[model samples]
Target: MKAESETKNQKADSTELDQSSFGLSALNFKLKIGFDGKRAANNLTGLGNYSRSLIEHLADQFPEHEYLVYAPKVKSARQIDAFFEKENIKLKLPKSGPFLWRALNILKDLTQDECQIFHGLSHEIPLAIQHTRIKSIVTIHDLIFLRFPQYYKLIDRKLYEWKSKSACKRADKIIAISEKTKEDIINLYGINPEKIEVIYQSCDDSFKTAFPKEKLSRIKATYKLPDKYLLNVGTIEERKNLKLVVQALKEVNEEYKLVVIGKQTAYFNSIEKEIEKLGLKNRVLFLKNIPFTDLPGIYQMANVFVYPSFYEGFGIPIIEALYSGVPVVAATGSCLEEAGGPNSLYVSPNDATGLAKAINQIIENPQLQKEMKEKGLEFVQKFNSSVVTQQLMNCYLSL
Candidate 1:
């Protein structure tokens, strides 16, 4: 009797889903999708960029589908106002409260919204929603905390590991940003490789466009940029290994300056100490709070873009440099090669001398620089928004 009753219930649930899908199809409507936009709404780092760009591209490619972004708080109207203006996109903020309350509110909203699919743009999903019928997907950017435990506090690493492991197990589908990330997920978590989808992310479209000469000149003057400089962008964190670039500066020609952009952390103090010790105080410039609109011009004006990070899921800065028609010199032993492509030069992460040589090679050889620029531009086409969006859409449709 128990088996017969369970079978009946399963059949009923299957019929219900079929009826619901058919009803939506009849109405010419697509699945209602929800995204965790905490990073998208507040942070401007790689996770935030990924969240924003994915949503923008998905909306542009598939306008018929509804997108609901759930966040703890909507901090800036300007940050998401443009997205809200679109008919198919809506921003859902939690009611005033603490973390648990806000999380419960978001879960309630997801259920009430009747979201057919809920995508955690980062490595998290509401535990409350696991019982719901909503299909869950999570994008696991990297396992950096697991790989480099020393770089993170014990408690933080434990928290991240728990969240990531739980999300990978709970998600109906896993989106890995790179092949390296996908492999890490499989090996670390023992997840079946078939369950994960690899999708590459493109930088902001702004990088692909060129600013007028007068505007570029104005930006250069406003920033007080040198005539020629090697550029490095990313937060001032040890994992980024920016000290290698500073060390490389000691070996490079005196006329070649090094410009570092991105937020400064405690690590900046150590890097500054090294710069002073090497007598490169004036030659190495550290910039903070650079306007987003000015980054493309800065990349275009660069003699070479150096990314010596010890590891990454995918290097957006390299792609940005590629889009901006700049030669790239990135480190090996991670996904940087995938980001920099075949034409860009790569050196060992800790090899300051090799980095210096690569930078000088590009700087002195105009032909090599032009070749890298051309090849990178061609290589970057595979990551275009239209291409990536379609791949993401296919993942959604499969579910």
Candidate 2:
């Protein structure tokens, strides 16, 4: 602990420790790696962002290594434009049968490309990946469907189970995004705990940027944001528990409104109905379809960030909030505590009163807010991009 502490003080960042500290300074390992790049190419969801961030940062940190992105189809979009142009990262697609291409291309493309390691950025790797000589890894984001069965339809649950189990069975190593996910894999799927590594995820680099006051003001005007508000980011699904915050809003300080930013689901109908019944319709603001570029400013403009999700594999929004210098208030049931650290407050997902108390505590006290913000920013360095990328590289190097 002393050595680590001394190292942290010596370097500009903890992750910038001497490469020899990781036993990698002398090793000249330049690997050719492949990925199930669909998440990076075709998704704007959690899985998509995870793939894009990992790939892009890996390429940036280890420039000598070639990172091949294998996608069945590539979406034409602005956010994903970086992958197409990044050095050491190449996008590969099949000639035909786009749906079958990912499953069918593994043996051919990986072997032909001389890939030494193939990573499934989400849960499933190629079914035929085991047949080849390349070592394989799969990142299991969460077992939410298995953990909370009621939320998913039976057929969807079964399909997710099959894919996850197959990937765990076929992968040489399992990288769980959180310790809870690792435990779920072992408990639900009976995977060996020894084969699984807990690797946390980093939020986008944009969230860490400090926007100029003029830019922040422009964004505030564009969104028609309230003078001071609480922020929540995630999909508006039942498991996410956005309703908990809405319920708390009626009891918290009258001056602070709740700003909700996320994609909506049918569950939102119930949330809307509850807001209407509570007579706090004007107190809650919903920002749907906000561009990713505007997200950092939104987080920076917040008075506090609340994510009362019932469960998660790893809470990236918590990390984003910390990077934005906002204190976090999250649910206690899952990995939210890990993301928020000890200084940030945690309330039971079901306790609207406790949630309101925690919110008022942060909102009403300036010193507490400042302490949480400073300590939160310090705590989130563990999920720093360089740190996570190095951990991932070490995992690959272990093989």
Candidate 3:
């Protein structure tokens, strides 16, 4: 009797998923999809860009499904409108404090929107909607709390860990950005393998090839960037391992500058002090905010792109560098290997000597650089938006 009852429950859960209501033409029973994001469209870093690109593809690929983008404020909504103007994608920005806004918006989405699935782009979701009818899915970007507990304060770490564990437990489905991230999730939260889907992200269309020499020259002059420099793109954070890049420059004989591009964080003082100590004031340049459209030109002007990070869930800049047709020197292990593939020259993360040796190898050998650049372009095609989005659609449709 118990075995027969268990089979019936399994049948009921399977029946709850309406297979006929999939794809764009199923407007009569369209799945109202709600995406939660905190940042504005233009303020996109790794998570923000993932949300932007994935959501845009979702809107285009499945036009029949109702897509509602829930953000914290009108500024983000306006930015979304400007960035992604798809007819099916609707932006909802509530006028309230962050906490209350998330609470009220989530409550409304669960009750009124009649959404079949609610995806929390980040870890945190609406705790208040615990008893609501909407099914929940969360993307665990990384296990930063477990991986690098030293970087975050005690309260932040504790809260993040708690929320992440809870989300993993409650989620109907989970999406892991990388395999390493998936492993972390399994180790930390003990989520079932079948419950979590591994979907690798892709570079945006903005990171592709540029126009003719004339247009490239205009963009190059506009930014006042060097014709050739070693590029490192990411925030000025300790975990990002910017110090290794600084130390590597001392070993290189090349005259090309090292350009560090990203916004300054609160803890950038140590990085600044290190640069001053190294007497690299002239050699190291900081371009804080480069326009989004002009990033490809900046990549075009680079001799090589290096990412010596100690840790990452998925390093998007490495993909951008590869897709931009630049030779890369990324760290050996972790998600860098997954992103850089077998074509990249790998070096130890914190070893300045190893980084310097890799940089020297690239600079001294012109043919190696050309060959690596070709391989990078070839490797990057596997992670194109169209391809990754189809994987995402497959996962969503399976749900």
Candidate 4:
């Protein structure tokens, strides 16, 4: 706690350093941006991961320009400073309004901050904000609300649909995480293709290295993972289509287990029932809320990583598994193919028999695994954080 406090104080002092000369440098044209980081703890999903990764990389790479992180009620000044405590980073106080407190607060702060550009990492943007001068960028991760509307609750579907459409319409620039998603925005949302850019997300650097055998062993012991288990990483939600994966697993009973790592959602009862019906309660394990630091070890322990989600913005875990040197088997449709490229074995998303066969084929063949790993590594280079950061910086410049 004391260490965290000291770090917070250091950040407070650093931000006090001169930001008056911000617009002078070419890097300053990179822009001072705001994002909804307030969704860190409670409602965390893919958006939270996207927000955290983008903010950390932006602050580290662009120290000359200013970054104003907007959050609700500053709870732990330590957590805020740890993420955005650099010389150019500043934290604005939360504002109150009719929408959720954090949303309302961020909406209010845009009027006050001397930012050149603003980014809504999530789908929603402050439609009421008097954006008379500053340019805005909103990242529409995917148009899942339109594509998979039945998966979401009615209220959530309506809210996300309204906000997503409004944000795309209002922003000066839009970022789609994949080309598939970019097409979805242009087709489903009727946004112009020229206005949007496709920037893929990268796996963490830690995943690229071979985790120490001892570390892998420790994680394996903790989770009781099989000697050669298949891995799936994501929130256990309805849209993730884990029931299909479970069905696939039942047909291919081997020495391996299907180990799932993610938080279980409220609507996952049907999946649970499916697992019970398949008699896979012992074979399929759901390990929820594992820390990011621990994920590389888990990935390293797996023989093959599988992500059979029906849809995605960009499947970070697919490449993450690839980088960890685990062979990947993903569904043919959606962004998994984009992430996995030619290397990954892709089966139809809803085909339990095909998915089962793919998993078994990878298990039986060692050479296939080696080929997939090498091809995955080659494809992963394009989406490196450094490369993606430059692309993002260029987008900011364009804005």
Q: Is candidate 2 or candidate 3 better by lDDT?
A: 2
Which one wins by lDDT: 3 or 4? 3
Candidate 4 or 1, higher lDDT: 1
Question: What lDDT is reached at residue 179 by model 3?
Answer: 92
Q: Per-residue lDDT tens digits of candidate 3, residues 226-301?
A: 7568999998888888888988887776587798898788657887788889888778888877777778778877
* lDDT (tens digit, per residue) of candidate 2 on 1-399: 453364356444434454555565524757899999987999976778888889989999888899999887789887788677988999888745576677765568778889999998888988878877999999999999988999999999999999999999989999999988998999999999999999999999999879999999999999999998999998999999998899999998899999999999999999999999999988899999998889999999999999989989889999999999999999998888888999999999999999999999999999999999888988888887877887898788777
Which regions in candidate 2 have their CA more than 4 angstroms from the true location?
1-27, 95-99
Task: Kindly list the per-residue Cα lDDT of model 4 for residues 1-399, writing each as its tens digit.
Answer: 353355456544533332332333453344667765565322344655567677678778776667786766444544444655566666665655425645444655676776667777777666654355767888888888789888878999998889898889888888999999999999988998999999888866788788788887888788777776888888888778788888998887567888898877875798889988988887887887787778899988888888888898888888898778788988877888899888789998889999999988988888888888777777677777766776687677655
Clashing pairs in 3: none
lDDT of 3 at 379: 73
* Model 1 Cα lDDT, one tens digit per residue, 172-259: 9999999999989999999999899999998999998888999899988998999989999999999999999999999888889999
The lDDT, on a scale of 0 to 1, for candidate 3 is 0.77
TM-score of each: 0.90, 0.94, 0.87, 0.86
Count clashing residue pairs per candidate: 0, 0, 0, 1
Measured by TM-score, the strongest candidate is 2
The whole-model lDDT of each prediction reads: 0.85, 0.88, 0.77, 0.76
CA displacement after TM-score superposition, residue 72 of candidate 4 (Å): 2.6
- Relative to the unseen true structure, what is the C-alpha lDDT of residue 348 in candidate 1, on a scale of 0 to 100? 98
Model 3, 112: alpha-carbon shift in Å?
Answer: 1.8
- The TM-score obtained by model 3 is 0.87
Better model by TM-score, 1 or 3?
1
* lDDT of candidate 3 at residue 322, scale 0 to 100: 87
